[model samples]
Target: MSKRDLTDKGTISRKYAKKEILKTIIGYLVFYASWMIVTFWLLYFFEEIPHFDWILWILFYAVVIPFIVVLVSVTWYSYRYVKMFSFEVLESDIIIQHGVFNR
Candidate 1:
């Protein structure tokens, strides 16, 4: 909730936070740009692309489905990596923490 609490969890150095914030921003920008490209491509090529009879399903499955899958996959990685952080590192132990937002 606050900076103190966040620091209490782990030390996110300024350099690390700045780097990750840049990465997160760039990632979202890329996703937004891709979504724009897809939308515009579909809009401009609607008549050109053959839809047969299943227009709704075809449009969704052909364009939207793959985009959603890739977007989720990429965003998940970026989100997870956003906080340049470490939590309770044990002495020579092996583990990975699963979380979102890293609170």
Candidate 2:
């Protein structure tokens, strides 16, 4: 469609390109997967320390709780972010709207 048509207030808003969405998803998967791997490694490493059972307890809470909370929030936020995101081209300007809770 023409930029002019997109410029109309509510006439046309386009979502992100497929390549962009795929890239974003892959990036997230890589990041979170690495995080889990490192956390598990740390837990295993700490198990050998003397009297570090306390430390293990602390790590459990520090890693698991925050991981769950952050993961869920990020998932929800990204879903909303992608759903709400759009761009429009005007005659002399471009408008992009993104984000969910923070936008």
Candidate 3:
């Protein structure tokens, strides 16, 4: 048996990039939504919790805003990443390589 080199500089289509980015964003949202629901429930369940009301606002601004910013940044980068990525499927092996440092 001989190994075949199926590697080619395949182009990354726009539709593929959009699909991947949307999938990533949806995954992030699903995880974030569940965690936020639990957090809100805990915050509301506790009665007469001192300073909790103020803490809620502080945590929302400090944590949530930064997360949203980072998520957007990551999605943008991921679009570029897909553009620069490569996949190889050989007769007996498969490979995937991705990076943008040298691009």
Candidate 4:
């Protein structure tokens, strides 16, 4: 399928550069990794505290798993986004279209 916008001078439609996908993935990875480090560090710190042993398992199940799931979901979404993304330069305006949920 093609995403298009009409223009008097005709449309210049293009997909995002492949490098953009790599760049975005790297950025997200760095951000998530830092947060994850802090999260796990806190879990470790708390686990060392007296009577806080259960905090590790509880937080692991409640926080760590969800964070990992979100990370994977976002990565998949970004990859799909790069594949489907397109922009059309019209005579008077530009229209960009891409959606992971609805396209």
Using TM-score, rank the candidates from best to worst. Answer: 3, 2, 4, 1
> All candidates' lDDT scores?
0.55, 0.58, 0.67, 0.59
Q: What is the per-residue lDDT of model 3 for residues 26-87, given as tens digits with 9 covering 90 to 100?
A: 77677777876777678779753548667678568856786688678877876777777775
Q: Pick the candidate with the highest lDDT.
A: 3
Q: In model 1, which range of ten residues has the least summed lDDT? A: 1-10
- Which is the better candidate, 2 or 4, if ranked by lDDT? 4
lDDT of 1: 0.55
Highest TM-score: which candidate? 3
Model 1 agreement with the true structure over 1-103: per-residue lDDT tens digits: 3333332235334565456556656776677668767765886787565455665675567656866676666556555564534453344442234333334
- TM-scores, all models, native as reference: 0.37, 0.44, 0.52, 0.43
Question: Per-candidate RMSD vs. true structure?
Answer: 10.1, 7.1, 6.1, 7.7
lDDT for residue 30 in candidate 1, whole number 0-100: 77
Q: Between the candidate structures 2 and 4, which one is better when assessed by TM-score? A: 2
For candidate 2, lDDT tens digit of each residue in 1-103? 4654565443222243344445656666677568767866886788844356875775577655665666666566556556666565677765665433233
Better of 1 and 4 by TM-score: 4
Please count the clashing residue pairs in each candidate, in the order shown.
0, 0, 0, 0
TM-score, predicted candidate 1 vs. hidden true structure: 0.37
Off by over 4 Å in 3: 1-9, 48-59, 86-103
Q: What's the lDDT of the predicted structure labeled candidate 4?
A: 0.59
